[model samples]
Target: MNTVTRPRILVVGAGFAGVECVRRLERKLSPDEADVTLVTPFAYQLYLPLLPQVASGVLTPQSIAVSLRRSKKYRTRIIPGGAIGVDLKSKVCVIRTITDQIVDEPYDYIVLAPGSITRTFDIPGLTDHAFGMKTLAEAAYIRDHVIAQLDLADASQDPVERASRLQFVVVGGGYAGTETAACLQRLTHAAVKRYPRLDPSLIKWHLIDIAPKLMPELGEKLGSSAQEILRRRGIEISLGTSIAKAGPEEVTFTDGRVIPTRTLIWTAGVVASPLIATLGAETVKGRLAVAPEMNLPGEDGVFALGDSAAVPDLAKGDGAMCPPTAQHALRQGRHVADNVIASLRAQTMKPYVHKDLGLVVDLGGTDAVSKPLGIELRGLPAQAVARGYHWSALRTNVAKTRVMTNWLLNAVAGDDFVRTGFQARKAARLKDFEYTDAYLTPEQVRARVEGARAPE
Candidate 1:
């Protein structure tokens, strides 16, 4: 008697699109239909939009991190690793496990959604000096770092050193940079009140971006409103500016203005995962090129989405691709799963079209700007809309409850501004987290796989 081998479905990354895809596939596909697997270092899907809150102590890290195994709908076999390379022709994916073991995973169907890394330029001392906001660890590290600055400044006698320690320079005017600057600044403000000896006026935050306007996607009125709110809070907004050089204690702006600060948070932009380069496929703006159906052009049983895929935007209907946003990535994930199942069942696959959902920029506290459903809102109303949207988008009820509870507790009791001593405990630099040189070459992948199978 011979048993029929089930089709293997492997998914890369646990980001917004990758998590959604695995969830949908797990729900739709039966055990006999396919065996699903997911490759990721962590078993949780990070709610990236609220990372700033984590750094600001508004929300705990665990509150925003949705566990993958929490739901009973999960049926996929999770592999604790990150993809290093892909052999498209051989239907194989090479993954670097948490233990540093290289394993080759074979699949009949594959979904590439390895997400993105913080895009950095060749600015001097950037990798060694700057902090990042892309991961939970980074947020936690930043929280401790920001609070530590206050501690050190309070203990210091030198006025120049205190001023430098009190200053923070945030690069990028996009959502992450803007929100991070706003949230962390609020943290410092509430924190400085605790130190009677430290001058509150010495604490300064400079928000600089190459773009002329802040959050241009939020439209003119909403963008201006956010800028005004931040400006009113004493934030220095330097428009049409970028970092020329990043140093240990200073960052020189492109406009030749030098800022002396130990904190340099880079939230400029993101590039597609280095995994995209392994496929050696065409890309649109650093992302893997995919059809409107979220499948590779001529590659059989392979699909890509999220920040790594340049999925065509049919709703725009002008040869445009979907922007790398959670809204688009989640929707695309569901659609790709449907298409994959449709393909297996010999049914028609549908194209992924995204409708405009406007934008939201939470400036911490009651200050926020939103253009939900094309209606511009500001202050408390916008904050409500923004938080409501994010809260509703969380995958689990437990996560929502924790986040809401955090908000309530923060409102009633406020923060203690305690530094967990992560600065001396760990290296929280940009290079320490995102290693640009970590990916494996194609030859190295083949050698490792062949060597592993040699014993057989």
Candidate 2:
């Protein structure tokens, strides 16, 4: 008689991918059959779709963050840390805990849904002059920074200083960048009413990117309509342009135009986390290459998904790959979990195949755009659909209720726009939150090993 060891599944990164993976695994697997664990830096899974709302004061910071412990009902243990490296051959992962300790955890099966990090360019002074909009910290920083800018503009004696303090530049024209600009501009408009000394006209917002059109992925017609609404609301949309240089008090664009501004938001794009490349697996554009089943090819009991994995879009012909978005990530996570359980049972695993469901872009206030099921929508009705869709998409009741309450309060009483006073006056640069350079590669690791042996 052979005694079967309980199958152990370890999910890394608690973003859409990791969280959904564990959620599905718990639902499918019997307690006696498998043991599941999730590793994440935080106890909550942040609803990234509403990050722009949080930055713009439409929602509070906690509204978008759902507690993972409260949401998960299964026996899965949550490890509070980040997976820094993986030893695929040994089936061990090196994780860095929040307390700055390194530990190794072994697993029978590993789900590499580590997600992506911000991809910054090599623009002059960008690392030192720009702010990021990727994480909770960055979003909170932007909120306080915007309010502080208004306060500074009100107090400045020199017109140039005041103008610089009031001018805001948002780089990137994707949904994230556009929504952030729209929401922040609304906050400024609402908050400046309190500062009688400040002129709302002095507050200028410029959205710049090298893309010929804003959100071309959203199809042409809806994209144009969304851009028009933003333009009508006093937003300067500079297409086919990018920042040439950034300074403490000015931003120089590729069009040979320079604007004096202290606020520079960088939201250009994202790449897979450096941890993926460390696994010594095939990678596409920094993302781990995985099969349609979300399993890494040639690797046993290993899988990846979300922004960190290059998942093929089997639904689309011509060998196309899915774009990194929350919608796809959430679905991919559930599919991967099912596959993991199938593997344990020695059953057939299913491939991840889901058609693109449409996208929604909230432009703050009663202005928005959406394309659900190939139908294009815009204006107020679209805004309602967008908010409703996102509110329903939230994972937890507490999160849903909090977000709805914030939206209702804002609608009734308007935004407070008061700076949280956290991370204020502390100028944040692009490099402060994200690292642009590639981390230690195999060659570098080899050299480090050789040096350590030779010297000490």
Candidate 3:
């Protein structure tokens, strides 16, 4: 009797980890040996680090998102869907396709890299009044919304409404929040020139965070310099503070200060996708707990990486977990791929380790800050390095070229300031993106009511 080995690997979420894993696995395993399938909600990989640039018109949205098929030359199949649930015991994953159809697929091995979703706070009116910057859709919506607001402010006859429309508030001093404020401020400054009726001074930019310092991870010197640049550009920086309440017209701060603003961008933080909770596995800080090799303990043939996995940072000397950033995710993806191939061949797997390689921040235009190696840099040189680094880091040549072209055009001319007009009306609900069971279909509701009335 002859034994045939069946090997099919399912990779959830085509972000940094899943994409790298599939690309490497394709190289390591021959076409006859195994099949690789990559699952994601979208067809492209979003370069999140430079998303603020996209929102501020520094780069078009297409520049940051590289299509999966365009980048990979291997035979990996791309499955367009979001994994809703995973039964670790059965090695089956329940996925919800874009059209809302549900399907369960089984795999010989699985790599969980579902990534994360925006972490919302319980502050009053936040869900109704705040905008999140987690997805490409959200970023695009913000870009349109900001430009639209400028238009509205210039056109409005009422002074109060005009003031509200012009004022922008962002909560979170972390990299995402700070970069967003910087980028949007630059956008409005350039855009207001087109609207002579509106003063750039009327367009207020406020950045608030509960932390004592901005970009604390960037160290004191660089963070302070970044904050100073933003302040000089008329951006109001409020540290050790947060919003207590947010209304349609204004936001009240915890410190009893109130600001009239229609825009409240939230980049406070992110947590692992809800799919992790459905896996029935131990998780640390909402992430699936995994060994340094990115394998789930006690779960055979199952692995996890990227933001969804709590990978220990051995390079830190201490046992702290790796921070969720593109820097770590890129490296983790490669390590996980090698480990997976090693596992398939019954070989020893190496541990994942990486040190902080400094940070780069583009403050839109010629203002930027960075600390490549151990030396701190700022101003035009920093801006050059920052943009250059992002350009080089792009996964595909198409994305790289598109981004470069956008920059060149912007430099020669200026922002078109043309709104895509997607979010003329607000999308205030999470269910708008991912429908929940609480929202039953008409058929489901009727069936449920009928089943209730029919004797048990």
Candidate 4:
């Protein structure tokens, strides 16, 4: 007598979409229904919206990293690796494990939610000198680097060295760039009190974007409101401007101005993960193009979502694709899980549909702007809504407790302005955080699946 093998369902990320999809799958599917496997380098689902808080020392790194193994309901075999490539025709995924081991994983159903990487231009010294705010390691390292700058500036006898260390430049005016500059600026503002030798007046932060307006999606009124708040806090806002070149000690702007600074934090934007290119599939603006049901056209049992996929926005009807936001990714995750279940049961799959739920910008402290459900709010009210929404979105009780405790502790006692000193010897650049060149070529992927050893 022959026993039937359970169908394998592979999820290729631990981000908001992938984690939510895995959780929903585990909760709804029986133990014998299918074998679930999650492929990711880390075991935690990073709450990216609150990353600036982590970098600012308002929250610990573990507070935002919701562990995948914490759930008792989890039956998915977790693979501590990243899926570098996927072959749709052969239904195989090539993975590079954390220990430098290569493996091939075959699956009956595949969910491509590999997310995105920080987008960078060909500007000189960008890949070498710029720090990113995308990963947990980067955030932690940035905190140390920021604190180190303060320490160095305080001890420096040369006015030029001190001035260069005191100034900081942040690129991009979108939510990530704005919030990162705001939170880190607040960090320096509070930390300056601890350094007796450093002059608080010397500290400066410049926020620049190529776009004419800052966070244009927030509407003119709220956008201006946000600008006013930042300007009031002494953050220099330069719109319709971007970096022409980046140097180790300074950055040149497109508007023919050069600013001397030791730190350049790039939160400009993101493009889909490089893994999407291995499939040789159609893409819209660097994101994989998927059907409204979140499945790749003409490929059964293959699905995609999150930042890697250009999922059509059914609600917005004019050939529009959903924006790469956590809100849409979270919803799309659950919807895609339901569709996966339907596919297994031979039922019809429904299209993913969600309306714009408005935007929130946490500028650290009581300065926040939010338009939840079309209601525009600013100051204390907006701050409350923003924090509440983020706090409630956490997945587990353990995570929620840790985050709340951290928030309370921060509110009551404040930060110590100390650096961990781990990043002093580490490489903390855009290329270091995002391994954009790690994915295998399409031909190599096919060879790997066919039992041939491909070139390293």
Candidate 5:
């Protein structure tokens, strides 16, 4: 390899994968050897596993948001923006800043770890009414919005309005939906005591999914256990059902049940970042196809991983791809970085093979479920495994300390049902956060890269 200046390495997305990749690159290579730049909408890597706690007010946003610049490798340039387009042929990446400025950044090598966004469908009124729990702002907004519902219900004399305000419909019984319903249900259960005028039974939480069970990843036994716990707490668990129609005040399920509720949380699933489609590459299951070494075949100086890329599940040996998870993302990020460094030095690169560690679901309170190293656990034991995994996943000590402190404080302190009125100014909607409408066509991408025409 021959070069006058150091290779400019551009990493898209400051998520678990992207952050770990940059950190590894920073540690392995000096600034004089290779320049590293990261593009992300935020300066912090969100500890997404803890986002439910944030939505429940158990943990503050800052506690789960790990800082990017605090690492020992401080030379990496942080570009606070999201990648809108990538011109692989010209080796230029187009970025849209937080302020909406479009800029083109040239890179000698690029890492695509753009993570994911909430998956939504064509359900009527879904975008305008439903809330999401993917981002930090969404979690905080949800916390405020849920509390606001209780406050509004307490003050309103109209039973109709009060009933609607107290009921919450959370669609999708995956980990996010399950944990969200569980945690927030506990919040309202403990909170209704403050509202002496309000009927406790009016506060209802419905966890619905098209799937047959709750958190099937936790396995059947634990999944059944989670369902029983939620049922005991009076949470209406509806399986094999999804939102047929959604409105500001009510949601109609596919099973012909119309539920009145002011709050609707959509956690059905997540698709790869829209940026992944801009590359005009073949994808496997909505994710960019990548080699086990995390490199794009036939394309030099390019790598993709995390939820955005279909990383082969080498450990499974079943022609399968690694599941989109924080655990896999963290490992992929670190391994991809090492592979990138090897490419820079013209050295041999190794394939990424990771076995599944386990799964954990914090149902809030003392109840939880986990499967660590194939051993199923429930109750207190599961809670420890769940928390221990999250605590260790946090990159910085500051984040760990804050999260631990928040956990301790929340356990000891009594519930304070206060609404910040976040939704009063502007209701939290699905469309506001992730820009699902933004994406470039294959023709547009080819034109941009080939210099046939400017990207729109």
Candidate 6:
């Protein structure tokens, strides 16, 4: 008797797109149909939007981290590693595990949704002296660092040191930077009362962006409102400006102004993961280019989506690619899963299409701005919409409960402002978290895959 081998489906990333795709595939595909494998550095799908709250001590790190192994029905093999390279010709991916072990994984069907990393420019000292808000570790480290700064400021006798320690700089006026600045400002503002020696007036938050407007996607009126709200809270909003150079003690702005500070949070933007380059495929603005159905044009059984893929914006048309947002990524993930199943069954695949559901900006406490379903809202109403949307989007009941409990606890009991001290002696930088140089070259990927298959 002859036995048939099952088709292997490999998904790279455990982010919004990858997790959604895997879940959908697992639910739809029969056990005998295919073997599904997930490649990821961590075991959780991080709820990235709430990372600011995590950094501000409003929510615990585990609350936003939705575990991947929670599904009892899941049969997918989870590889505790990151895909560093993909050899499209050989249908193999080169992965670097958490223990620094290298392995080559082959697949018949591949979904490239490895997401993105912090995008940095040619600016000097950026990789060395900046803090990022992308990952859970980064958020936790930032919280500890921020609290330590306050502790140092309170204990110091030198006025200059105190002043520098009190000042914080955040670049990028988009959702991440804006929310980070707002939430952390609130943390410091509330915590300063405990430190009677430190003057509240000395705590300054400078929010600068190279773009002319703050959160330009929020439109003029809403953007103006956000800017006004932040400015009212004493946050110095500087438009059309960015950091020219970063130092251990100060940062020099592009507009030729130098500010003394220890904290420099860089949330400017993100670029496609370095893994995308290994395939040597066509890309639009560093993102892997895919068809309307989320598949590579000539590559059989190969798909790409989320931040790594330049998926066409069918809703907006006019040759526009979808913006790298959680909304689009989540939808694209589900849509691509359907396409993958369709291909397997030799059925017609549908193109990905979805209208915008509007945007939400949580500025900590009751301050928020949201345009849910095109209905503009602000203050308490906006805050309600923002939190409601986030709570509903959580994948698990446990995640929702934890997040809700955290919100209630924070509102009633408030924060303790204690430093975890995990990142005390370590220097956390852009290069540290985002190992951009860890990816293998296309030639190296091909060699590794072929070498593994060769007889010893």
In model 6, how large is the Cα lDDT of residue 11? Answer: 99
TM-score of each: 0.97, 0.94, 0.93, 0.98, 0.97, 0.99
* Per-residue lDDT of candidate 3, residues 1-456 (tens digit): 998866888999888878888888988888888788888879888899988988888888888988887744669987887777776666677777877776667788899888888887788998877888877778888899899888888889999999899999999998899899999998898889989888777889999999999999788889999999999999999989999999888999999999998899988988887777777789999899999889998988899998989999998867799988888988888888888888888999999989878788888888889988877999999988888888898998788899999999998998778897885765543324432232233343334445444786
lDDT winner among the candidates?
Answer: 6
Q: Mind giving the per-residue lDDT tens digits that candidate 2 earns over 47-76?
A: 888999999888989899888777445689
What is the C-alpha lDDT profile of model 4 across 1-456, one tens digit per residue? 999999899999999999999989998999999999999999999999999999999999999999888867678999999999898988889999999898889899999999999999999899899999899999998888888999999899999999999999999999999999999999999999988888899999999999999999999999999999999999999999999989889999999998999999999999999999999999999899999999999998999999999999989999999999999999999999999999988999999999988899999888999999989999999999998999999988988999899988988898768798866876678788888878999988887787644555
Residue-level error in angstroms, candidate 5, position 65? 0.8
lDDT of 6 by residue, 366-407 (tens): 899999888888899999999999999899999999999999
Off by over 4 Å in 3: 1-5, 425-456
Which one wins on TM-score?
6
lDDT, candidate 3, residue 372? Answer: 85
lDDT of 5 by residue, 345-378 (tens): 9999999999999999999988999999999999
Q: Candidate 6 has which clashing residue pairs, if any?
A: none
Count steric clashes of candidate 2. Answer: 0
Model 1 TM: 0.97
Where model 6 places Cα greater than 4 Å from the true spot, the runs are none
Candidate 6, overall lDDT?
A: 0.94
RMSD of each: 1.5, 2.9, 4.6, 1.8, 2.2, 0.9
> TM-score of model 6 relative to the true fold?
0.99
For model 5, the superposed segments whose C-alpha errors exceed 4 Å read: 1-3, 71-73, 446-456
